[model samples]
Target: MRLFGYARVSTSQQSLDIQIRALREAGVKTNRIFTDKASGSSVDREGLELLRMKVEEGDVILVKKLDRLGRDTADMIQLIKEFDAQGIAVRFIDDGISTDGEMGKMVVTILSAVAEAERRRIFERTNEGRYEAKLNGVKFGRKRSIDRHNVLSLHQAGIGATEIARKLKIARSTVYKILEEMKVT
Candidate 1:
C-alpha cells in the first residue's frame, strides 16, 4: 500500500514546514506529499483535492493533526467516511489517532460528536456576545470620514466630485454617493 501525506496551514502567512517535516519523518516521499495554505473550511483547496484523487484503495493518508484535514468535526467525519468507502485509512501523527477498523471508526465518531457540540456552543456564545454588545450602543464598522454638510457645500460651490474627493481625502465614489443622497432628499 502506498503512503501519502497532506499538510495544511490555515493562512497563507503561516508556515507548513513543521507538518511537512513530520510527514517526511513518517516515511512519506516528498513527491507524495500535498500541501495547502488556505482555510480548512474551504473544500476547494488544490492540495486536498489532489491528495484525494491520488490515493488508491489500499493507500494510507497521513496528517500532522486532525485539523489539517478539515475545519469542523462534521467535515472531518465526512471526509473519513468517504475515505473508508474507498478502503483508505487516515492517520494523525500528533494525536496518535488512526482509522483502519470498526473500533477506530467508533472512536472517530465519538470524537467528532464531541467536537461538533463544542463548535455549536462556541457559535452560540459568540452570537450572544454580539447581541449584548449591540444592545449596549456599540456601533460596528468604520466611521464615516467625510462630513455630509462639507460634501453638500463643495458640490454647491461648483467643486467637481473628483476635486472634492482629492481635497477631503475621500473616495470619488463617496462624493457621488453623498451627492445622490442629497438629490434624494
Candidate 2:
C-alpha cells in the first residue's frame, strides 16, 4: 500500500518539523509528505487536497493527530467515514490509530468524542463569564461611543451621516449607528 504522510500546523507561523520527522522515521517516503499550515476548521486544506489527489484505495494517509485533520469530533468522524468509504485508511501517528484496522477506528472515535466534549466545555465557560459580566452591570460591545449630550446635539442638528462622521472623526457607519441609538434612547 502507498504510504502518504500528512503534516499540519494550526497556523501558518508554526513549524512542521516534529510531524515530518516522525513520518520520515516511520519509513514514509519524502515525496509522499504533504504539508499544510492552516486552521483545522478547514477541510479543503492544501496538503489534504494534495494527499487526496495522490492517494488511491488501499493507500494509507498518516497524520500527527486527529485534531490536525479537523477542529471537532463531527468533522473528524466525517473525514474518517469518507476515507473508509473510499477503502483508504487514515493513520494517526501519535495515537497509533488506523482506519484500516478495527481497534484504531474505535480509538479515533473516542478521541473525537473527547475533543467535542472539550469544545463544548470551553463554550459553556465563555457563556458563563458573559452571564456574570452582565449580572455585574458590565456593558459589552463598543461601550457607548460618546456621552448622551454629544450624541443628542448631533442628532438634533439633522446633520447628514457623512457630516456627523467628519465632525466626530469616526466612520460613517459608527455615526449612523450612534444616530440610531439616540433615536431608541
lDDT of 1 by residue, 66-99 (tens): 9999887777787887888899999999998998
What is candidate 2's CA lDDT for residue 29? 95
TM-score of 1: 0.64
Candidate 2: misplaced stretches above 4 Å? 10-14, 65-67, 70-77, 139-185
TM-score of each: 0.64, 0.61
Which stretches of model 1 miss by more than 4 angstroms?
Answer: 119-185
For candidate 2, the 10 contiguous residues with the lowest summed lDDT are 143-152
lDDT of 2 by residue, 45-88 (tens): 88888887888899888888767777756667778777877889
lDDT of 2 at 38: 85
